[model samples]
Target: EGDSFRIDEPIYLYIEPIGYTIKENPKSSYEFGFFADFTIEGEDGKVLGGQKDFAKLDFKSWNFNTEITLTFTYTISFFSIQVFPQYPDLFSHQDNQ
Candidate 1:
């Protein structure tokens, strides 16, 4: 995966969580679920935006599966270089590009 992404481009993520809690379902199946939160930060450590519980996964299986994969997709549309009021020229340069 690259560190840089274009505006409004789709970003894909694959995650594997360890030591997550598993519960027994009423139907004699095992159940597991998780929620994820995310934040977008600039190089200067300023939090640009974020979402709580942006992705959620729940599963029920007959076997206690040790391997699980979670996939998440995100698109950044609201982010803008114009956020920096102190850098008017920077915004203009981006527009010219």
Candidate 2:
């Protein structure tokens, strides 16, 4: 069976926000929540994963919840890499924040 992919093989994953609504909080960062359906599609247009009505975005800052949304444009991107057994930790413990 050659159906299994190799560990070092490269894959592409893309994320696009079809629609979203923003609410202004005004004191600090932007306090925004949205209801959207998303799908994880591979380079060949095959859907690997998806979610409906999912809203789980958290900010870990003192003024996180108090952030007011202002007139701004944002761009979000996603990337992935294959980690082999020979490689060291991609991220250090302290870098997790």
Candidate 3:
């Protein structure tokens, strides 16, 4: 799933999930999912790691295997979004990706 995330400097790392609804639970046009996140020490080769909860998707694209990597000299955040397909249809889709 080639998913990754990284924040340079100081940022809250804003995010939102997109994909499916209650009734139909169909695939959404925008479904963002966070796979991994971590921080690094500029001066030294140190790293700060964190875990992700796949239970909730933050952003999504059509290709689940796309390469999304944010650069910051020390670390980078990789991600991808794409609507593939869901179980049901006629579901209320939220415009968040």
Pairs that clash in candidate 2:
25-68, 25-69, 26-68, 28-67, 29-67
All candidates' lDDT scores? 0.69, 0.37, 0.31
Candidate 3's residue-wise lDDT over 1-97, tens digit each?
A: 1122222212333333234332212564444444433433222233333334423435545554344443222233321121112312111212122
Off by over 4 Å in 2: 1-33, 56-97
Residue 54 error, candidate 1, Å = 2.3
Q: Sort by lDDT, best first: what order?
A: 1, 2, 3
lDDT value for candidate 2? 0.37
For residues 1-97, write the lDDT of model 1, one tens digit per residue: 4555656667787888899988988888999999888877654556667778876778899998889988878777675667655642221111011
Candidate 3 regions exceeding 4 Å error are: 1-9, 12-32, 48-56, 59-97
Against the true structure, whose TM-score is highest? 1
Q: Is candidate 1 or candidate 2 better by lDDT?
A: 1
* Residue 60 displacement (Å), model 3: 8.0
- Poorly placed runs, candidate 1 (over 4 Å): 84-97
Candidate 2 lDDT, 13-81, residue by residue in tens: 334443444445555445455454555444345554556765565333334343333221212233234
Models ranked on TM-score: 1, 2, 3
Which one wins on lDDT? 1
